[model samples]
Target: MIVAEKKPIEEIIDQVKDFQKLLIAGCNECVTVCEAGGKKEVGILASALRMYFMNEGKKVEIDEVTLERQCDHEYLEEIRDRIDKYDAVLSLACGVGVQFMAEKYFSTPVFPGVNTCFMGAAEERGVWSERCQACGQCILGETAGICPISRCAKRLLNGPCGGSTKGKCEISKDLDCAWQLILDRLKELDRLDDYEKIMPIKDWSTERAGGPRKVVREDVRL
Candidate 1:
Protein backbone atom coordinates (compact mmCIF):
# COMPACT_ATOMS: atom_id res chain seq x y z
CA MET A 1 0.00 0.00 0.00
CA ILE A 2 1.09 3.56 -0.59
CA VAL A 3 1.60 5.41 2.69
CA ALA A 4 1.27 9.13 3.23
CA GLU A 5 1.51 11.70 6.01
CA LYS A 6 -0.61 14.77 6.41
CA LYS A 7 1.01 18.12 5.87
CA PRO A 8 1.15 20.56 8.78
CA ILE A 9 -2.06 22.51 9.32
CA GLU A 10 -0.14 25.78 9.08
CA GLU A 11 1.07 24.99 5.60
CA ILE A 12 -2.40 23.88 4.49
CA ILE A 13 -3.96 27.05 5.92
CA ASP A 14 -1.46 29.21 4.05
CA GLN A 15 -2.29 27.56 0.74
CA VAL A 16 -6.09 27.98 0.90
CA LYS A 17 -6.28 31.18 2.88
CA ASP A 18 -6.80 33.27 -0.22
CA PHE A 19 -9.68 31.16 -1.52
CA GLN A 20 -13.15 32.06 -0.24
CA LYS A 21 -14.59 28.72 -1.28
CA LEU A 22 -12.46 25.61 -0.67
CA LEU A 23 -12.99 21.89 -1.08
CA ILE A 24 -11.30 19.27 1.07
CA ALA A 25 -11.32 16.06 -0.91
CA GLY A 26 -10.41 12.71 0.56
CA CYS A 27 -9.83 9.20 -0.80
CA ASN A 28 -11.31 6.05 0.69
CA GLU A 29 -8.53 3.71 -0.36
CA CYS A 30 -4.89 3.67 0.71
CA VAL A 31 -5.08 6.98 2.50
CA THR A 32 -7.93 5.63 4.57
CA VAL A 33 -5.91 2.58 5.56
CA CYS A 34 -2.97 4.74 6.53
CA GLU A 35 -5.26 7.10 8.44
CA ALA A 36 -4.01 10.12 6.57
CA GLY A 37 -6.67 11.37 4.16
CA GLY A 38 -9.90 9.45 4.61
CA LYS A 39 -13.46 10.52 5.38
CA LYS A 40 -12.66 10.85 9.10
CA GLU A 41 -9.50 12.79 8.37
CA VAL A 42 -11.41 15.05 5.99
CA GLY A 43 -13.88 15.86 8.71
CA ILE A 44 -11.08 16.51 11.21
CA LEU A 45 -9.31 18.81 8.80
CA ALA A 46 -12.55 20.61 7.92
CA SER A 47 -13.34 21.21 11.56
CA ALA A 48 -9.88 22.51 12.25
CA LEU A 49 -10.01 24.84 9.31
CA ARG A 50 -13.45 26.06 10.24
CA MET A 51 -12.36 26.82 13.81
CA TYR A 52 -9.27 28.63 12.59
CA PHE A 53 -11.18 30.82 10.14
CA MET A 54 -13.90 31.57 12.67
CA ASN A 55 -11.39 32.64 15.28
CA GLU A 56 -9.60 34.80 12.77
CA GLY A 57 -12.81 36.70 11.92
CA LYS A 58 -12.53 35.47 8.34
CA LYS A 59 -15.19 33.84 6.23
CA VAL A 60 -14.20 30.73 4.28
CA GLU A 61 -16.50 28.17 2.83
CA ILE A 62 -14.96 24.72 3.16
CA ASP A 63 -16.77 21.61 2.00
CA GLU A 64 -15.69 17.99 2.44
CA VAL A 65 -16.11 14.99 0.13
CA THR A 66 -14.54 11.55 0.18
CA LEU A 67 -14.25 9.63 -3.07
CA GLU A 68 -13.71 5.91 -3.53
CA ARG A 69 -10.48 6.86 -5.19
CA GLN A 70 -9.01 10.04 -6.59
CA CYS A 71 -6.84 8.30 -9.17
CA ASP A 72 -9.64 6.91 -11.34
CA HIS A 73 -11.73 8.83 -13.86
CA GLU A 74 -15.05 7.27 -12.89
CA TYR A 75 -14.60 8.09 -9.22
CA LEU A 76 -13.37 11.59 -10.04
CA GLU A 77 -16.36 12.28 -12.27
CA GLU A 78 -18.57 12.14 -9.18
CA ILE A 79 -17.46 15.65 -8.34
CA ARG A 80 -17.35 17.14 -11.85
CA ASP A 81 -20.61 19.06 -11.49
CA ARG A 82 -19.76 20.45 -8.06
CA ILE A 83 -16.05 21.05 -8.68
CA ASP A 84 -16.64 24.40 -10.28
CA LYS A 85 -18.33 25.65 -7.12
CA TYR A 86 -15.07 25.78 -5.21
CA ASP A 87 -12.22 28.20 -5.81
CA ALA A 88 -9.63 25.56 -4.96
CA VAL A 89 -9.42 21.89 -3.96
CA LEU A 90 -7.20 20.39 -1.28
CA SER A 91 -6.69 16.72 -2.11
CA LEU A 92 -5.85 14.43 0.77
CA ALA A 93 -4.90 11.62 -1.54
CA CYS A 94 -1.47 10.45 -2.61
CA GLY A 95 0.67 12.44 -5.04
CA VAL A 96 -0.68 10.42 -7.97
CA GLY A 97 -4.26 11.13 -6.98
CA VAL A 98 -3.57 14.84 -6.57
CA GLN A 99 -1.98 14.97 -10.03
CA PHE A 100 -4.84 13.00 -11.54
CA MET A 101 -7.39 15.37 -10.01
CA ALA A 102 -5.43 18.37 -11.29
CA GLU A 103 -5.24 16.90 -14.79
CA LYS A 104 -8.92 16.01 -14.88
CA TYR A 105 -10.13 19.33 -13.51
CA PHE A 106 -7.64 21.59 -15.18
CA SER A 107 -9.52 24.78 -14.26
CA THR A 108 -9.40 24.36 -10.49
CA PRO A 109 -6.17 24.70 -8.54
CA VAL A 110 -5.41 21.34 -6.86
CA PHE A 111 -3.13 21.28 -3.87
CA PRO A 112 -1.74 18.21 -2.11
CA GLY A 113 -2.59 18.04 1.59
CA VAL A 114 -0.30 15.10 2.38
CA ASN A 115 3.24 14.02 1.68
CA THR A 116 3.43 10.81 -0.34
CA CYS A 117 5.75 8.58 1.65
CA PHE A 118 6.34 5.24 -0.12
CA MET A 119 5.05 1.89 -1.27
CA GLY A 120 5.04 0.01 2.00
CA ALA A 121 3.27 -2.43 4.25
CA ALA A 122 1.82 -1.84 7.68
CA GLU A 123 4.23 -3.10 10.34
CA GLU A 124 1.76 -2.24 13.06
CA ARG A 125 -1.04 0.19 13.61
CA GLY A 126 0.19 3.62 12.49
CA VAL A 127 3.51 2.17 11.36
CA TRP A 128 4.52 1.36 7.82
CA SER A 129 7.84 0.20 6.36
CA GLU A 130 9.05 0.53 2.77
CA ARG A 131 9.06 -2.71 0.82
CA CYS A 132 9.33 -2.00 -2.89
CA GLN A 133 10.92 0.62 -5.10
CA ALA A 134 9.07 -0.57 -8.25
CA CYS A 135 12.45 -1.03 -9.94
CA GLY A 136 10.79 -2.52 -13.07
CA GLN A 137 12.60 -5.86 -12.69
CA CYS A 138 11.77 -7.92 -9.65
CA ILE A 139 14.42 -10.10 -7.98
CA LEU A 140 12.43 -11.29 -4.98
CA GLY A 141 12.34 -14.86 -6.30
CA GLU A 142 16.13 -15.08 -6.17
CA THR A 143 16.40 -13.31 -2.83
CA ALA A 144 13.84 -15.49 -1.02
CA GLY A 145 11.12 -12.78 -1.07
CA ILE A 146 13.07 -10.06 0.72
CA CYS A 147 13.49 -6.91 -1.37
CA PRO A 148 17.01 -5.51 -1.36
CA ILE A 149 16.13 -2.50 -3.47
CA SER A 150 14.02 -1.00 -0.75
CA ARG A 151 15.48 -2.46 2.41
CA CYS A 152 19.16 -2.10 1.70
CA ALA A 153 20.43 1.37 2.46
CA LYS A 154 22.88 1.17 -0.43
CA ARG A 155 20.45 -0.60 -2.80
CA LEU A 156 23.03 -3.30 -3.28
CA LEU A 157 22.17 -6.06 -5.75
CA ASN A 158 24.65 -8.60 -4.32
CA GLY A 159 25.21 -7.62 -0.80
CA PRO A 160 25.53 -7.52 2.89
CA CYS A 161 28.39 -5.55 1.53
CA GLY A 162 31.50 -5.59 3.72
CA GLY A 163 29.66 -3.08 5.88
CA SER A 164 27.28 -5.63 7.38
CA THR A 165 28.32 -7.26 10.67
CA LYS A 166 26.46 -9.59 13.01
CA GLY A 167 23.45 -9.48 10.64
CA LYS A 168 23.08 -5.73 11.15
CA CYS A 169 23.82 -3.04 8.61
CA GLU A 170 26.77 -0.82 9.33
CA ILE A 171 24.55 2.16 8.65
CA SER A 172 22.46 1.49 11.71
CA LYS A 173 22.24 -1.03 14.51
CA ASP A 174 18.47 -1.11 14.30
CA LEU A 175 18.52 -1.86 10.56
CA ASP A 176 18.73 -5.53 9.64
CA CYS A 177 21.03 -6.53 6.83
CA ALA A 178 18.76 -7.30 3.89
CA TRP A 179 21.26 -9.70 2.35
CA GLN A 180 21.59 -11.55 5.63
CA LEU A 181 17.84 -12.00 5.71
CA ILE A 182 17.99 -13.30 2.14
CA LEU A 183 20.72 -15.78 3.02
CA ASP A 184 18.77 -17.08 6.00
CA ARG A 185 15.63 -17.43 3.94
CA LEU A 186 17.52 -19.20 1.19
CA LYS A 187 18.96 -21.64 3.69
CA GLU A 188 15.53 -22.33 5.10
CA LEU A 189 14.21 -22.99 1.58
CA ASP A 190 17.18 -25.33 0.78
CA ARG A 191 17.99 -23.00 -2.13
CA LEU A 192 21.26 -21.71 -0.81
CA ASP A 193 23.05 -22.87 -3.98
CA ASP A 194 21.11 -20.28 -5.97
CA TYR A 195 22.96 -17.58 -4.10
CA GLU A 196 26.21 -18.45 -5.90
CA LYS A 197 24.72 -17.53 -9.29
CA ILE A 198 25.52 -13.91 -10.03
CA MET A 199 22.61 -11.67 -10.88
CA PRO A 200 22.81 -9.78 -14.17
CA ILE A 201 23.08 -6.02 -14.29
CA LYS A 202 19.55 -4.67 -13.96
CA ASP A 203 18.10 -2.64 -16.85
CA TRP A 204 16.75 0.43 -15.09
CA SER A 205 14.72 1.52 -18.11
CA THR A 206 11.78 -0.51 -16.89
CA GLU A 207 11.59 1.81 -13.90
CA ARG A 208 11.08 5.61 -13.92
CA ALA A 209 13.90 6.12 -16.42
CA GLY A 210 11.60 6.38 -19.46
CA GLY A 211 9.19 8.97 -18.06
CA PRO A 212 5.48 8.20 -17.64
CA ARG A 213 4.54 4.56 -18.04
CA LYS A 214 1.40 2.84 -19.26
CA VAL A 215 0.26 -0.74 -18.94
CA VAL A 216 -2.19 -1.76 -21.63
CA ARG A 217 -4.29 -4.89 -21.72
CA GLU A 218 -5.60 -5.00 -25.29
CA ASP A 219 -7.79 -7.92 -24.33
CA VAL A 220 -9.71 -5.81 -21.84
CA ARG A 221 -10.22 -2.80 -24.07
CA LEU A 222 -13.58 -2.05 -25.60
Candidate 2:
Protein backbone atom coordinates (compact mmCIF):
# COMPACT_ATOMS: atom_id res chain seq x y z
CA MET A 1 0.00 0.00 0.00
CA ILE A 2 1.07 3.62 -0.38
CA VAL A 3 2.45 4.90 2.92
CA ALA A 4 2.10 8.52 4.03
CA GLU A 5 2.76 10.61 7.10
CA LYS A 6 0.76 13.57 8.43
CA LYS A 7 2.08 17.07 8.12
CA PRO A 8 2.62 19.16 11.27
CA ILE A 9 -0.35 21.19 12.49
CA GLU A 10 1.65 24.41 12.34
CA GLU A 11 2.55 23.78 8.70
CA ILE A 12 -1.04 22.99 7.83
CA ILE A 13 -2.25 26.09 9.66
CA ASP A 14 0.17 28.22 7.71
CA GLN A 15 -1.24 26.95 4.44
CA VAL A 16 -4.92 27.58 5.15
CA LYS A 17 -4.78 30.37 7.74
CA ASP A 18 -6.13 33.03 5.39
CA PHE A 19 -9.17 31.00 4.41
CA GLN A 20 -12.36 31.57 6.42
CA LYS A 21 -13.82 28.32 5.21
CA LEU A 22 -11.92 25.08 4.75
CA LEU A 23 -12.61 21.46 4.01
CA ILE A 24 -10.47 18.64 5.37
CA ALA A 25 -10.78 15.61 3.15
CA GLY A 26 -9.52 12.19 4.08
CA CYS A 27 -9.19 8.80 2.42
CA ASN A 28 -10.55 5.49 3.68
CA GLU A 29 -7.77 3.41 2.20
CA CYS A 30 -4.02 3.40 2.76
CA VAL A 31 -3.85 6.51 4.90
CA THR A 32 -6.54 5.09 7.12
CA VAL A 33 -4.47 1.99 7.84
CA CYS A 34 -1.38 4.08 8.47
CA GLU A 35 -3.28 6.41 10.85
CA ALA A 36 -2.43 9.52 8.92
CA GLY A 37 -5.54 10.46 6.90
CA GLY A 38 -8.80 8.78 7.63
CA LYS A 39 -12.21 9.59 9.06
CA LYS A 40 -10.76 9.68 12.57
CA GLU A 41 -7.79 11.76 11.49
CA VAL A 42 -10.03 14.20 9.61
CA GLY A 43 -12.04 14.86 12.72
CA ILE A 44 -8.86 15.43 14.71
CA LEU A 45 -7.48 17.87 12.18
CA ALA A 46 -10.75 19.68 11.88
CA SER A 47 -10.84 20.12 15.65
CA ALA A 48 -7.28 21.42 15.72
CA LEU A 49 -7.98 23.94 12.98
CA ARG A 50 -11.14 25.07 14.67
CA MET A 51 -9.32 25.58 17.95
CA TYR A 52 -6.50 27.43 16.26
CA PHE A 53 -8.87 29.83 14.58
CA MET A 54 -10.90 30.39 17.73
CA ASN A 55 -7.80 31.15 19.78
CA GLU A 56 -6.58 33.56 17.13
CA GLY A 57 -9.80 35.61 17.50
CA LYS A 58 -10.92 34.55 14.04
CA LYS A 59 -14.06 32.77 12.96
CA VAL A 60 -13.64 29.87 10.55
CA GLU A 61 -15.97 27.29 9.14
CA ILE A 62 -14.33 23.89 8.95
CA ASP A 63 -15.91 20.78 7.49
CA GLU A 64 -14.61 17.21 7.60
CA VAL A 65 -15.26 14.48 5.05
CA THR A 66 -13.73 11.12 4.21
CA LEU A 67 -14.12 9.58 0.80
CA GLU A 68 -13.88 5.89 0.06
CA ARG A 69 -10.94 6.94 -2.04
CA GLN A 70 -9.93 10.42 -3.05
CA CYS A 71 -8.16 9.18 -6.17
CA ASP A 72 -11.30 7.85 -7.82
CA HIS A 73 -13.42 10.19 -9.92
CA GLU A 74 -16.61 8.65 -8.65
CA TYR A 75 -15.76 9.40 -5.02
CA LEU A 76 -14.50 12.87 -5.84
CA GLU A 77 -17.71 13.78 -7.65
CA GLU A 78 -19.59 13.43 -4.39
CA ILE A 79 -18.24 16.81 -3.31
CA ARG A 80 -18.89 18.58 -6.62
CA ASP A 81 -22.18 20.10 -5.51
CA ARG A 82 -20.61 21.73 -2.46
CA ILE A 83 -16.97 22.05 -3.47
CA ASP A 84 -17.31 25.75 -4.13
CA LYS A 85 -18.58 26.29 -0.60
CA TYR A 86 -15.04 26.12 0.77
CA ASP A 87 -12.19 28.55 0.32
CA ALA A 88 -9.73 25.68 0.06
CA VAL A 89 -9.51 21.91 0.40
CA LEU A 90 -6.87 20.13 2.49
CA SER A 91 -6.62 16.65 1.05
CA LEU A 92 -5.44 13.85 3.32
CA ALA A 93 -4.97 11.36 0.55
CA CYS A 94 -1.74 10.37 -1.16
CA GLY A 95 0.00 12.75 -3.56
CA VAL A 96 -1.79 11.05 -6.43
CA GLY A 97 -5.18 11.80 -4.94
CA VAL A 98 -4.23 15.40 -4.18
CA GLN A 99 -3.08 15.94 -7.77
CA PHE A 100 -6.18 14.27 -9.14
CA MET A 101 -8.40 16.54 -7.09
CA ALA A 102 -6.46 19.58 -8.20
CA GLU A 103 -6.80 18.60 -11.84
CA LYS A 104 -10.48 17.75 -11.53
CA TYR A 105 -11.39 20.99 -9.80
CA PHE A 106 -8.87 23.26 -11.53
CA SER A 107 -10.28 26.41 -9.91
CA THR A 108 -10.37 25.37 -6.28
CA PRO A 109 -7.13 25.46 -4.31
CA VAL A 110 -6.14 22.02 -3.12
CA PHE A 111 -3.48 21.38 -0.48
CA PRO A 112 -1.80 18.19 0.60
CA GLY A 113 -2.28 17.26 4.26
CA VAL A 114 0.20 14.40 4.31
CA ASN A 115 3.61 13.63 2.85
CA THR A 116 3.46 10.63 0.55
CA CYS A 117 6.30 8.32 1.51
CA PHE A 118 6.46 5.22 -0.69
CA MET A 119 4.86 1.95 -1.66
CA GLY A 120 5.47 -0.31 1.33
CA ALA A 121 4.06 -2.72 3.88
CA ALA A 122 3.49 -2.45 7.60
CA GLU A 123 6.13 -4.45 9.46
CA GLU A 124 3.99 -4.09 12.56
CA ARG A 125 1.66 -1.59 14.18
CA GLY A 126 3.04 1.93 13.72
CA VAL A 127 6.00 0.64 11.73
CA TRP A 128 5.94 0.64 7.94
CA SER A 129 8.89 -0.40 5.77
CA GLU A 130 9.62 0.31 2.12
CA ARG A 131 9.08 -2.71 -0.08
CA CYS A 132 8.90 -1.77 -3.73
CA GLN A 133 9.99 1.19 -5.81
CA ALA A 134 7.69 0.22 -8.68
CA CYS A 135 10.75 0.25 -10.96
CA GLY A 136 8.47 -1.15 -13.75
CA GLN A 137 10.91 -3.91 -14.49
CA CYS A 138 10.37 -6.66 -11.94
CA ILE A 139 13.34 -8.94 -11.16
CA LEU A 140 11.94 -10.70 -8.09
CA GLY A 141 11.50 -13.94 -10.00
CA GLU A 142 15.25 -14.60 -9.92
CA THR A 143 15.86 -13.12 -6.47
CA ALA A 144 13.69 -15.51 -4.45
CA GLY A 145 11.02 -12.88 -3.72
CA ILE A 146 13.46 -10.41 -2.11
CA CYS A 147 13.54 -7.11 -4.00
CA PRO A 148 17.08 -5.86 -4.37
CA ILE A 149 15.95 -2.75 -6.24
CA SER A 150 13.97 -1.33 -3.35
CA ARG A 151 15.81 -2.97 -0.47
CA CYS A 152 19.35 -2.31 -1.62
CA ALA A 153 20.95 0.92 -0.50
CA LYS A 154 22.47 1.35 -3.95
CA ARG A 155 19.77 -0.42 -5.88
CA LEU A 156 22.32 -2.88 -7.11
CA LEU A 157 21.08 -5.64 -9.46
CA ASN A 158 23.75 -8.09 -8.40
CA GLY A 159 25.57 -7.35 -5.19
CA PRO A 160 26.53 -7.80 -1.64
CA CYS A 161 28.84 -5.03 -2.51
CA GLY A 162 32.16 -5.01 -0.66
CA GLY A 163 30.48 -2.46 1.57
CA SER A 164 28.32 -5.10 3.20
CA THR A 165 29.69 -6.67 6.39
CA LYS A 166 28.23 -9.16 8.82
CA GLY A 167 25.07 -9.33 6.64
CA LYS A 168 24.46 -5.60 7.13
CA CYS A 169 24.62 -2.78 4.60
CA GLU A 170 27.58 -0.46 4.59
CA ILE A 171 25.25 2.50 4.99
CA SER A 172 24.04 1.27 8.35
CA LYS A 173 24.54 -1.66 10.66
CA ASP A 174 20.80 -1.56 11.37
CA LEU A 175 20.11 -2.16 7.71
CA ASP A 176 20.32 -5.68 6.31
CA CYS A 177 22.22 -6.17 3.10
CA ALA A 178 19.58 -6.76 0.43
CA TRP A 179 21.84 -9.05 -1.58
CA GLN A 180 22.58 -11.09 1.51
CA LEU A 181 18.87 -11.53 2.08
CA ILE A 182 18.45 -12.63 -1.52
CA LEU A 183 21.31 -15.08 -1.29
CA ASP A 184 19.87 -16.60 1.87
CA ARG A 185 16.42 -16.82 0.36
CA LEU A 186 17.72 -18.46 -2.80
CA LYS A 187 19.73 -20.95 -0.82
CA GLU A 188 16.67 -21.93 1.21
CA LEU A 189 14.72 -22.42 -2.02
CA ASP A 190 17.55 -24.50 -3.51
CA ARG A 191 17.72 -21.93 -6.33
CA LEU A 192 21.21 -20.66 -5.49
CA ASP A 193 22.19 -21.51 -9.07
CA ASP A 194 19.93 -18.76 -10.33
CA TYR A 195 21.97 -16.21 -8.44
CA GLU A 196 24.96 -16.93 -10.72
CA LYS A 197 23.06 -15.55 -13.72
CA ILE A 198 23.70 -11.83 -14.02
CA MET A 199 20.84 -9.51 -14.77
CA PRO A 200 21.05 -7.30 -17.86
CA ILE A 201 21.07 -3.55 -17.52
CA LYS A 202 17.57 -2.45 -16.54
CA ASP A 203 15.45 -0.54 -19.04
CA TRP A 204 14.57 2.43 -16.89
CA SER A 205 12.43 4.08 -19.55
CA THR A 206 9.60 1.86 -18.35
CA GLU A 207 9.79 3.64 -14.98
CA ARG A 208 8.86 7.16 -13.85
CA ALA A 209 12.21 8.30 -15.29
CA GLY A 210 10.37 8.10 -18.61
CA GLY A 211 7.74 10.54 -17.29
CA PRO A 212 4.19 9.96 -16.09
CA ARG A 213 2.97 6.55 -17.19
CA LYS A 214 -0.45 5.22 -18.11
CA VAL A 215 -1.98 1.89 -18.94
CA VAL A 216 -4.68 1.23 -21.50
CA ARG A 217 -6.76 -1.91 -21.31
CA GLU A 218 -8.92 -2.29 -24.39
CA ASP A 219 -10.91 -5.09 -22.81
CA VAL A 220 -11.87 -2.97 -19.81
CA ARG A 221 -12.47 0.30 -21.63
CA LEU A 222 -15.93 1.45 -22.65
Candidate achieving the largest lDDT = 1
Candidate 1 regions off by >4 Å? none
Tens digit of lDDT per residue, candidate 2, span 46-81? Answer: 999998899999999999999999989999999999
**Candidate No. with top TM-score:** 2
lDDT of 2: 0.93
What C-alpha lDDT do the candidate models reach, one value each? 0.94, 0.93
Clashes of each: 0, 0
In candidate 1 the C-alpha lDDT for residue 88 amounts to 100
Across 1-222, the per-residue lDDT of candidate 1 in tens digits comes to 899999999999999998989999999999999999999999999999999999999999999999999999999999999999999999999999999999999999999999999999999987898999998889898899999999999888875799999999999998899999999999999999988898888888888997877889999999
Give the C-alpha lDDT of model 1.
0.94
